[model samples]
Every structure is written in C-alpha cells, then in structure tokens.
Target chain A: MSCWETLADYALRSVGIGERLLPRSDFTICQQVVLIGSGMIWNVYFGVLALCSGFFLATAVALGKASHSVWLRKPSEWFIFIFRGSPLFIQFFFAYFLFLSLKQVAPIFTPFTSAWAGALVVLFLNTAAYSGEIFYGALLSIPKGDTEAADAYGFSGWARFRRIIWPTMLRLAWPAYTNEAIFLFHATTLVFFSGFPAQQQRGDALYYANYFADKTFNPFIPYPILAGYFILLTLLLIGLFGLVNRRLNRHLPRERRAKVRFRPNVIR
Target chain B: MFSYCADPDTLSGLTWLSCYLTTGKHMAFYVSFGTVLLLLAITAPTALLFGFGGAAAARARFFPLRWVGKAYISVVRGVPDIAFFLFFVIALDQGFEWLRHKVKCPDWDQPIRQGSDFVVCDAAKLPLGNAAQWVHETYGFFLAVLTFAIVFGAFAANVLFGAMRAVPHAQLETAEAYGMTQRQTFWRILVPQMWVYALPGLSNLWMVLIKATPLLFLLGVEDIVYWARELGGTKTPRFTDYPHGDWRMWYFLVLLIFYLAFTRVSEVVLDRVMKKLTHGQATAGGEAQRKAA
Candidate 1:
C-alpha cells in the first residue's frame, strides 16, 4: 500500500483507532514513523493526565509532609519515601499484581487490573511522590521573612497559605517540577514493558519502536524516531513550564527572576 | 534442606512452606540478587571510567573529539533512558556479531540481514552455537553491563563535565602561575578538586543506577523481577508441591522492601562520604564544617 494509506491506517494505531494488525514485514520508514508517532498519543495521554491529577495531590502531600501534626506528617513522609525510593519498574509490577489481587477480593477493582487504570494510578502516585518531595524542599526553603510578612498583613492560616506561601513554594519548585514532568513523560514508556498488556497491541512509543526493531532486525530507525518525538515533547514541556515559571515570578524584577535551566537528573 | 521436606507432596503446614522456599528455583532466585549486586559493582567503576573519558574528551583541544564527547553527554538529555536501554542491547549484540562475521568469515558473503534474521556463521556467533550455558549467560550479562555503563556514562559525564566547570578557574590559574603545566594542573589540581562538586550529582546518579538494576530483566537476564513473576504465579498442586494462589504482590512487596532498604543505606553512606570529601574543601559544605570545627 501507499505510504499515505499506511499513515492513515497506522497513525492512530496505538489507541486502537485505525490499523488492527501492525506491519509485520516489508516495513517502510513511513510505517515506523506513523506507528511510533501514533504510539506517542498514549505517552501524551498518560503524561498529561497523570501530571495534571498528580499536581493537586503533590501539593497536599507537600503540606502533609511539612505539617505540624504527627498524624498527617508520618503517612506523607512514608508515602513519599516508598514511592521515591523504589524503582518505578518494580512499582509498576507491584501495583499491577496488587490491583490484580484486589480484583480477586472485590469485583470493583476489576477495571483497575487493566493497564488503563492501573498504570495510570501508578504513574500518578509516583509523580506525586517525587513532585511532593520537590515541593516539600521548596516549602522548607521559603524565607521566614515571607511568613512573617504574611503575619504582618494579618493573613492567617488558609489565607496565609493560599496568598503568600503556595505561590512562592511553587516558584521555588518549578524547575525541579519541570524535570519531574519530563521524566514522568519519559517514564510512561515503562507501563507496557511492566507487564501491563497494551490492549489490542496498542502501546506507547517505545513499544512500537521496540516492535519495529524486533521485526526489521534494525534498531537505527525506530528508536531514533521515538527519541525525536520525545525531544520535541521535552522541548514543548520546557516551553510550557517556562511560561508558568514566568507567571510565578512575574512580580520579581527581571534581574531577580530565575532563568529555567534544564538539568536532567533521574528523579525516579 | 530438612529431611522431612524431601517429599513435599506429603508435607503440610510449616514443613511444606519451608521446603517450597528452599526449592532449587528459590536458590536461583536468591542468586539473582547477587547478579544485580555484581552488575552494580562492575558497572559503577566502568561507567565512571567512561564518564571520565567522556568529560576529558569533551575538554580536549581537538574540535572533533570535543564534539563527539559533547554529543555523548547530551544524548541522554533528550530521550528516555529506557529507550537507550532497549535499543543498545540488540544493536550492540548485532554489532559484535557483525564484526566477528567480517573477521571470522570474510568470504562467506550471505548477506547478514536476510529479511529479519541476522545470520552469522557459527564461528561468528557471540557464544558460539555450542558454547556452554554459563558462557551464554555470562555474555548476556556482560552486554547488559556494557549497555548500562554506556547510558549511565553519559549521565555521569554530564555531572562530571559540570563538576569540572564548577571547579574555580582561579585554582587552575594559580596552578599555572606556580609553573604547573596544563596536564599537571588537570591531574593534580582539577581532578582532585572536582569530586567535591561532583559528589552530589554522582550520589544522585548512584541512586539512579541502583533503581535501574531491575531493567536487567528487560535485557533477558533472569533477574529478580523475572523470578517474582515466575514464582508468584498461581500453581496447581498437580504441577508441583507449592500450589498457591497468585502471590506476586507479596513477592513484589519483598522486592520493594529490598530496594527501599538499599536506597536508605546508600543515602546514609553517601552522606557520610560527602562529609568526608567536603572537609577543608573550598565549598559551602566545607565552610560549614570549618565553622563547626
């Protein structure tokens, strides 16, 4: 078939939208590009959803970790430690099995046994823990003068936090959080590999890349395409986060605003 | 191990549990942990060497060498590392075999890529077709270590390159003023001083390396994750003595605890090392130590 037809067939293949069977032989560059690009849909889906939902939980977790009450503090500390300490690959396996066993106990958990719910839940919790730790560090480093100023303005408790504390904490944490978001997107590639079966052969970018590599006995093409897609995604993320970061530090003088620097460290 | 455990089918209660846990497969499962540790032991120094080479090359006077090193270091930044891990394993394997093919059977020119199959002469095969099982396993493990070293070397190179830059330029200037050659300044001063700055990043990389050990399973080595899935699956009484429900959760739970404890211990040790390394250095940690003293 023509490359255009192949593109039309396989463009949304990862989401089970277009093509049914992936190209097995006579693999064209077009097929590899289209299928892997299609697979990126899932990566974006998982990354965006998990990051959006995780942000709120991370804020709560950050506060809980920094809270005065022992009841709130200990669980938050342990939550962050467990998720951050363990490998996400192991977490994915552990969570998949845990969800499976839960399904045995309660039929309600059956849906979670699938990759859709289970892997997303794992990614969400994992990012929350890492981001929560970053946020907690930022919270701790918030200048004492900031809080004193809030007290002086008679902004107490929730008002103090909402108005004075949250923004500053976020401003401090934005760079690390950006790194966490990029890593989280990179990490979405691990779900299918972690034994969460991609229903109907629909999988992420790495999955399709891996498929093409296996089929063609050539690793040169598909993997680089996957990497290119990821590089574009990473740049887009940096740009988006840069905009938020500017807004976070808008009140600061231009000389004082922190420039976003990409320091790629493995947060997992 | 117990005499009563021999006939596992007849045993009940604790005896059955004991025997099951001490099965031959369980021994292999236990040994895989050692494989992980072995991988770490080998990969750590090798990756550091690769990183050092990369950093030095990046700083080389030659433009092409510097560009190559810079590319090696920055490549990891844009892509997911898992992509590298998956790609490099097969690519490196084929690369090795292809090299061997060219050298070992130069005249036997059946194309290496016949459709999807990578056909090499028997002599060119990595382990040789009839090599012992242990040799095959060892070769696979070696390839895994190499792949880990390459990917992580890039990360370490990034850390080390920055650490190299973070070393105050004045220190090198003073060395030069003291009549130290560029080589002497680099070896005696720059290399020694860079560690203090590099420690935090290196420690973080160490934690990352520790977490990455489980990816060994993806390289087709029967590591802990492999055992967990294998042993945790539900088994029928007809199949073996240990007939149980799916216990993968518990197996993974144990893996989780193992990793958590590993990281906790690593963090403590790394902190102490950092303290020791920072003593009397020209850094904030050193200044804090000086004040405390």
Candidate 2:
C-alpha cells in the first residue's frame, strides 16, 4: 500500500481509532511515524491533565509543608518524602497492584486498575510531590522584606497569602516548576512500561516506538523519531512556560527578572 | 528450611511464612537486590569517568572534539532517558556483533541484515552461542551497565562542564601568571576547585542514578521488579508448597520502602559530604562556615 494510505490507516492506530490491527509485516517508515505520532496524543493527555490538576494540590502541599501546624505539616512532609524518594517505576507497579487488590475489596476501584486511571493517579501524585518541593523551597526563600511589607499594610492570613505571598512564591518557583513539568512529561513514557497494560495497544509515544522496534528489530529509526517528537514537545513546554514566567516577572525591573534556562539536574 | 514446614498445608502463621520466604526462588529474589546494588556500585565510577572525559573533551581546544563533547552532553536534555536506555542496549549489541562479523568472518558474509533478523556467524555472536549460562548473564549485565553509564554520563558531563566554568576565571589567570602550562593549570587549579561547584549537581545526579536503578528490569535483567511480579502472583497449591492470593501489592510496597529508605540515607550522606567538600572552598558554603567559626 502507498505511504499516504498507510498514514490514513495507522495515524490514530495507538488509540484504536483508525486501524484495527497494527501493520505486522513490511512496516514502512510512514507507518512507524504515524503510529508513534498518534501515540503522542496519550503522552500529551497524561502530562497536561496531571500538570494542570497537580498544580493546585502542589500549592496546597507546599503551603502545608511550610505551615506551623503539626497536623498539616507532618502528612505533607511525608507525602513529599515518599513520592520524591521512591522511583516512579516502582510507584506505578505498587499503585497498579494496590488498585487491583482494592478492586477485590470494593468494585469502585475497578477503573483504578487500568492504565488510564491508575497510571494517571501515580503521575499526578509524583508530579505533585516534585512540584511541591520546588514550591516549598521557593516559599522558604521568598524575601523576608516582602512579607514584612505585607504585614505593615494589615494584609493578614488568607489575604496576605493571596495578595502578597502566592504570586511571589510562584514567581520564584516558575523556572524549577518548568523543569518539573518537562520531566513529568518525559516520565509519562514510563506508564506503559510498568505493569499497566496499554488496553488495545492504546499506549504512549514510547510504547508505539517500542512496538515498531520490536517488530522491525531495528532500534535506529523509531527511537530517533520518538526523540525528535519529544524534543519538539520539550521545546513547546519551555516556550509555554516562558510566557507565564515573563508575566510573573513583568512588574520587576529587567535586571531583576529571572531567565528560564533549561537546567537538566532538577529531577528527583 | 524447617522440617515441620515441609507440610505447608498443615502449617500456619509464622512457621508457614518462614518456609515461604526461604524458598529457592525467594533466595534469587533476595539476590537481585544485590544485583541492583552491584549495578549502582559499578555504574557510578564508570559514569563519572565517562563524564570527566566528556567534560574535558567539551573544553578541548580542537573544534570538532568540542562539538562532539557538547553534543554528547546536550543529547540527554531533549529526549526521555528511557528511550536511550532501550535504544542503546540493542544498538550496541548489534554494533558489536557487526564489527565482530567483519573481523571474524569477512569471506563468509551472507548479508548481516537479512530482513529483520541480525544473522551474524556463530563466532561473531556476543558470547559465541554455546557459551555458559553465566557468560550470557554476565554479558547482558555488562551491556546494561554500559548503557546506564552512557546515558548518565551525559547528565554528569553537563554538571561537570558547568562546574568547570564556575571555577572563577581569576584562578586560571593566576595559574597562567605563575607560568603554569594549560594542562597543569587544568589539573592543579581548575579540577581541584570545580568540585565545590560540582558537588550539588553531582549529589543530585547521584540521587537520580539511585532512582533510575529500576530501569534495569527493562533491559531484561531479572531485577527486583521482575521478582516482585513473579513471586507475588497467585499460585495454586498444586503448583507449589506455599500458595497464596495475589500479594503483589505487598511485594511492591516493600520495594518502594527499600528505594525510599535508600534515597533518604543517600541524601543524609551526600549532605555531610557536601559540607566536608566545601570546608575550605571559595563558595557560599565556605563563607557560611567561616562566619559560624
């Protein structure tokens, strides 16, 4: 078949949309590219959904970790420690099995046994922990003078947090938070590799790349394509985060504004 | 291990648990933890060596060598590292076999790439086909280590390269003023001072390396994750003496705790090391220590 036909047939193959069966033999470059690109949809889904939702929880977690109350502080501290300390690969395995056992006890957890719910939940918690630590560090490092100024203006409690502290905390944390987002996106590749099965082969970019590599017994092509897609995705994330970062620093003098350079060593 | 424990059907409580945990397969499972530690032990130094070489090459006077080193360091930044782990093992295996095929059996070449199969002559095979089981396992382990070293070396190179630059230019200028050769200045002045700047990044990299140990399973080594899945599956009484319901969650929980505790201990040790390393250095840590003194 022609490459165009192959693209049409397999473009959404990973999601079980266009092609019912993957190309078994004579796997064309077109087929590999289309199928793997299709699989990126899932990666984006996992990364975007987890990051957006995790942001609010991470804020809460950062605050709880920084709070004076023992009740809030201890659980938040443990949550960050457990998630940040353990490998995400093991976390996925542990969570999948935990959810499976939970299903036996209560059928409400049946969805949690699947990759969709289970892996997403794991990524959500994992990103939250990493982002929480970044925010907490930022919160701690927030200028003492800024809070002192807020107190002088009678900004108290929630208003102090909302009007004075929150924006500054985020402004300080943005660069590292961007790194967390990129790593979290990179980490979405691990979901299928864990015990979580990709239902009907509806897996992520790495999953489809793995599929093509297995079929062709050639690691050269598919992996580089996957890498190229990820590079673009990483650049896209940086650009998107850079826009927000600029807004966060808009009021600051140009010299005081922080540049969002990609630092590679931030992953826990 | 206990004589009464042989009859697992009759045994209960601690006795039954004792027999189950002592099974031969369980011993292998326990040994796989050692495999992980061994991988870390070996990979750490090898990767640092690779990173040192990469950083030095990046700083080389030759343009091409510098470009190659820069590419090696930056490649990890764009892609997911798991792709590198999966790709390099297979690629390296084929690459070695292809080189061996050329050297060992040049005249006897049927094409190496026959459709999807990488059909090299038996002599050109990694462990030479009929090698002992341990030889194959060792070969596989060696490849896994090399793959880990290469991927992580890039990250370390990035750290070391930045650290190298962070060593104040005035230090190098003073070395040059003293009529020191470039190599001497690099070795005596730049290298010694870079460690303080490098420690935070290196410690962070060390934690990343610790966390990345589980990816060993993906390279087909029967590491802890493999054992957890194998041992935690539900077994029938007909199949084995110690049959149980799916206890995979518990097995994985134990693995999780193992990693958490390992990372926590590493963090504590690393912090102490950083303090020691920065004791006399011209950095913030040193400044703080001076003030405290």
Candidate 3:
C-alpha cells in the first residue's frame, strides 16, 4: 500500500476513527509514525487540559496554603503533600480504583471509568499539587516591599492580591512553572499504564508505541517515533512558556529580567 | 498460622483476617517493598557516579568528549523517561545477545532478525536461555537498575553541572593563590562548595527516583503493584482456600499510603542531610544555623 493510503487509514486510528482493528501481522515505519502521531493527540489533550485547569487551581491552592486561616491552609497543605509525595503511576491506579468504587456507589458516573475522565482527573490533581508547591515557594519569596506599597496605597485583601500579590507570585513562580509544565506533559505517558483502561485501544503515545512493539517485537522503530513526537512537544512547550515568561517579566528592566532556561530535572 | 487459621472455612473474625494477610502471596507483597528500597539504595550512588563522570566530561577541554557528555544529558532529558525504560530494556538485551553471538558463533551465518524472530545461537543467549527462572529474574532486575541509573544519571548530571558552576570562582582562585594544583583546588574547594548547591536539586531528584520505583511493575518486576493486582483480583473458591471479592482498590490504597510514607521519611532524612551539608556555608540555611548555635 502507498504511504498516503497507509496514513489515511491510521491517521485517526488512535481515537477509534478509521480502523476498527489495529494492523496485525505486518507493521511498517509509516504505520508506526501515523499511529504514534495519532496517539500524541491524546498526550497533548491530557497535558493541555490538565495544565490549563491546574493553573487556576494551583493559584487557589497556593493562596490557600499561605492563608492566615488554618482551615484553609491545612487542607491545601495535605492535598499538595499527598499528590506530590506519591508517584503519578500510583495516583493513576489509586484514582482509577477509587473512581471505580465511586461508580459502584453511583452507577450514573460510569463514564469516569474511561481514560478521558479518569486519567484527566488524576493529572489535574497531580499537576495542581506540584504547581501549588512551586507557587507556594514563589508566594513566600514575593518581595515584601510590594505588599507594603500596596498597603500604603490603601490596598487590602482582594485589591492587594489582584494588583500586587498575585502577579508577583506568578512572576516568581514562572520558571518553576515551566518545569512543572514539561514534567506534567511527560507524566501524561503514564496514564495508560495505570489502572485506567484505554477504551478500544484509544490510548496515548506510549500506549500506541507499546502496541506496535508488542505486534512486531521490535522496539527500534516505534519507540524512537514516540520520542521524536515528545521532544517536539517539549520544545513547543518551552517556546510557549518562554513567550509567557517574557510577558510576565515585561515590567522589569532588561538586565533585571530572568531568562528562563531548561533545568532538565523534574522536581517532584 | 494458628490451628484455627489452618481451616479458613471454620474460622471467623480476626483469626481469619490475620491468616489471610499472612499467606504466601502476601509475604511476597511485603518483600516487594524491600525490592523498591533496594533499587533506590543501589541506583542512587550509581547514578551519582554516572552524573559526576558526565559533568566532568562536559567540562573537559576536548570538544568531542564535551559533545558526548552534553548529548548524554540532553538525550535522556529530551524524551519521556518511560519510553527509555521500555526501549532500553529490549535494545540492551538484543545488543548483549548480538555481541555474544558474534564472539561465540562467528561461523554461524544467519540474520538475527529473520521474520520478527531474534534467534541468536543458543549458547549466545543471555543467561544461556535454559538458566533457572531466578537467573532470568535477576537479569531483569539488573536491566531495570541499569535503565533507572542511566535515566536518573542525566538529571543528576544536569544538577551537578549547575552546582559545579555555582561554586564561587574566588574560592578556586584563592586555592590557586595558595599554590594548590588545579586538581587539588578542585578536590578541596570546588567539590566541597558544590555539595551545598547540589543538595537541593539532588534531594528533589531523590524524591522523584523514589516515586519512580513503581515503574518496575511495568518492567515486569513483581513489585507492590504486581502483587496488588495478583492478590486483590476476584479469587474464586476453586482457585484458593480463602477467596475474596474485588479488593484491588483497597490494595492500591495501601500501596499509595506506603509510597507517601516512604516519600515523607526520605524528605525528612534528606532535609537533615541538607542541614548538615549547609553548616558553615554562606547560604541562608548556614546563617540560620550559625545564629541558632
């Protein structure tokens, strides 16, 4: 079969679109690329949705962790600790089982058994906890002078937070937040391996890579394709975050602005 | 283990529960936790050594050596670690076998990858193909350790490289002024000073490594996750004396708690070590210690 024909058949295979069954017997390089590329769609979807939603929740969590009220502070602290302390793999397993039990109690929530709902829920909470810690550090390191300036201008509570505290916290946290973004995207690969079942073979990049490897017993082709897609994804994330970092640091002088660089270590 | 517990059907209440939890499979479950700790104990120092070598090479004067060092760190960091875990195992296994085939059977003239069958000469097989099951299991564990070390070594190299640079330039210059050789200055001043900066990143990496131990299950190791699924699945009465309902959820919850506790203990230990390392340094932690003392 021609490359275009192969591409057409497998392009949407990961989402259960074109082919009802995956290729059996013979596997080709084109099929590996198309299927793994299709699988990357799930990775991007999970990462983007989780990070977008986790950003706001992480902000709330950071604020809660820093709140004067113990009621607010304690829960956030434990949430961050529980999620951050455990592996994402275990969290995926624990969440799937917990969700399974919850569905047993309430049968209407059966959709939560699927990867889309179950894995996303775990990723959301996990990223929130990690980003919450980063934001917490940033909150603590926020310049005291800014808060004093806000107070002198009669700013208090929401006004102070909106105008001064929040922005400063974000600015301080942006670099670590970039790291969180990269790691969270990488963690998306763990979704299929955990308790969450990929319905109809609709799995992530690593999932499809595993599928191809199982069929052919050849790791040489499929694994590298997955790696290439992820490296590209990481580069894309870095570029996007760099743009945002520029915007966040826009008010500072050129010399004062911090240039965000890849640290290559995931801080759990 | 008690007399009443011998016949699980006859027993009720806590005796049955105690006996059930102490079954052979459950004993394996308990042992798997030790496997995780053992992996961490072995991988940490090995990764650190790899990191040290990589960092040194990256800073080497030779261009090719520097490029190789940089490539090692970047390649690992660029891809998802789980991919490396899956890819390296098979690749390394095949690589060793291919080498063995070349050395053992040079006259044997057949392609290894003939129609998806990686058939090396029988003598060239890793563990010799007919080795005991334990030998195979040990070989797998060794591979998992190698994969973990290679992946984590890159992160450690990145941290150590940063930490080495963070060591104040004046300290090395001062050692030079005192007539110390480059190597002596590096040994006495640079390495010592780098530790304080390296501690934070290394501790963070250590926690990540701890959490990553569960991936051993994916690598086909009989880890806690493996035992959890094995023992927690719905067991029919025909299969066992003590059958149970679907309790995988509870089993996973237990695993989660185990990891959380492990991570917390590690954090405490690492925090103490950080404090010890920071003593007499000019950092914030050192100054706080100085004032308290």
Cα displacement (angstroms), candidate 1, residue B128, comes to: 1.1
Model 1 lDDT per residue over A140-241, tens place:
999999999899989998989999999999999999899899999999999899978888899989999999998888898899999899899999999999
How well does candidate 3 score on lDDT at residue B70? Answer: 93
How well does candidate 2 score on lDDT at residue B179?
100
Tell me, what's the RMSD of every candidate?
A: 1.3, 1.3, 1.6
lDDT of each: 0.92, 0.91, 0.88
The CAPRI class of candidate 2 is medium
Report the lDDT of model 2 for residue A229.
Answer: 94
lDDT of 2 by residue, B241-285 (tens): 888999999999999999999999999999999889889777888
Q: TM-score of each model's B chain?
A: 0.97, 0.98, 0.96
| Model 2 misplaced regions, further than 4 Å | A265-268
Off by over 4 Å in 3: A266-268
Q: How close is candidate 3 to the true structure, as a TM-score?
A: 0.97
- lDDT (Cα, tens digit) per residue for candidate 3, span A1-268: 8789888888887788887788786777888899899999899999999999999999999999999999999999999999998888988888888788789889976877889988898899999999999999999998889988899999998888898998899899998899889988888998898888888888888999999887777899899999899889988988999999999999999998877777655423
lDDT of 2 by residue, A1-268 (tens): 8889988887887778787888788887888888889999889999999999999999999999999999999999999999999999999999999999999999999999888888999999999999999999999999999999999999998999998999999999999999899998889999999999899888899999998888888999999999999889989999999999999999999999999988654234
Supply the DockQ value of model 2: 0.71
DockQ of each: 0.75, 0.71, 0.67
Task: Report, to 2 decimal places, the DockQ of model 3.
Answer: 0.67
